[model samples]
Target: MTQRHIIRRVRGVDTSDGAGVKLKRVIGQPALDTLDPFLLLDEFRSDEAGDYIEGFPEHPHRGFETVTYMLAGRMRHKDNHGNTGDLGPGSVQWMTAGRGILHSEMPRQEEGLMWGFQLWVNLPAADKMTAPRYQDIDPSAIPVVHPATGVTARVIAGELAGVEGAVRGVATAPVYLDLSLEPHAAFDVPLPEGHAGFAYVFDGASAQVAGQELARGDLGAFSRIGDTVSLRAGDAATRLLIVAARPLDEPVARYGPFVMNTPEQIHEAIADFRAGKF
Candidate 1:
């Protein structure tokens, strides 16, 4: 099997979103506009309550999917579709904004370390206007597997070995994993051919992947020439998020919080939201 290598590395930029909640924008930055099927990747981490207390007020989304994984802290979310849930440490919320939806996510704690990530996955044109849905997964529902010595993987979506993750029936079959590796530990992941893949190192000094070492906050994109991903930790422990998915390979039109195939569709979404359609 061919081994995937890093073809590009992007250092995240510090940005604020959702009423001044500080975060690091990795994929949506100018350096790397996007990876096919993956539109945005944001990491929110802070111990100061002032940084995230405002949280994400009511917002509208359409024509895409959003995945939120929490590493620490607690968040409460509610949508206009009569859905409410709480996400704690190790919890994951996968929401499909098919057609349109209005939602809000707010911090549930007064003060503490809050760390998490939110990823945006694009939907094919055919499924863009389907139906809004959600997969609110608790921490205990996720499967933890040991792929190698000193390697721990929490599978949120997709399969590791023969164990399946909690999320299924997604448009773009995706594999999302939160991995922690001890110093010098190594692991090999099998990916479907032609799928887009990337690794984001969040904790630790560095991690070796695809013949290159990625420092903290670095997002490395894998080459499409391979179907296997090789990961090795450096001298210190490392924690990272690795994800892969089938590419949509279609035209993408994006606005503030809406994604569609054409500019006209985006305008229509805005008009609908203003008319209280979402």
Candidate 2:
């Protein structure tokens, strides 16, 4: 018999505006300890232009990585390293805030309706100040594999169905996948051993895990998942982001966008960013 992976249903969060934009946080703002190895999660969903019109202005970050995964609409981003571009639906941008860097991202082309998830993954103390880099992944470039029974998976940062995403600069050994399961269909996803992962349903529908139901914006963490985790979609089907990260088992001392092992290092990162050293 397979042991059930009992998971706690942690609802998405809602927070105030920052970064010169109106941000409704989905995670990481209030519940810091809820998800170890992960930091922030922002859901920029808006159909009104005024809500996301301002967007995020130039800001500095250090010791962490910010991943922007777009669901709908577009985002124009630019960084101090002289790199600039935009991201449409299914596009992604991962920025490593090692040492320090300044960047900005604003909505584009939608008049509104910018839906995306910006995740913050913490780096181990030893690698916190390594260096900064960015990886822009296009939707078409990311492979989408369909298994039997209407199960679809988008390979973002790890192996899936023998296909993989081209996203480099990921140190967390994390596996990010966008999964969609048809009604009445089921999926058995295999996660690496000793890893921690969660699923955030976003299809506004219901999903069943060993008969337990979960709604949209509801996050579930498997406390004791085996190599494989089972999922079954409801009548309306299920859509969610399945994220798994390798446990770092290291010290985490974070301050704002910077994550380090010591407060002084965080202070130094800020000072360097201000002093143009990073």
Q: Which one is best on lDDT?
A: 1
Superposition-based RMSD of candidate 1 using all C-alpha atoms, in angstroms: 0.8
CA deviation > 4 Å runs, candidate 2: 1-4, 32-34
Q: Write the per-residue lDDT of candidate 2 for residues 1-278, one digit (tens) a residue.
A: 34347467777665545544556565665543536677776777778877777778888888878899999989899888898989999998888878788888877764857788888888877777777888889899888888657899888887777776668557888889899998887887777776777777887588876456878877777654577667888777789888878767777777676678777877787788778886
Q: List TM-score per model, in order.
A: 0.99, 0.93
Displacement of residue 86 (Cα, Å) in model 1 is 0.4
Q: Clashes in model 2: which pairs?
A: none
Question: Which stretches in model 1 have alpha-carbon errors above 4 Å?
Answer: none
Scanning candidate 2 in windows of ten residues, the lowest lDDT window is: 13-22
Instruction: Please report the TM-score between candidate 2 and the true structure.
Output: 0.93
Total backbone collisions for each predicted model: 0, 0
Q: Write the per-residue lDDT of candidate 1 for residues 181-218, one digit (tens) a residue.
A: 99999998888888898999999779988889899999
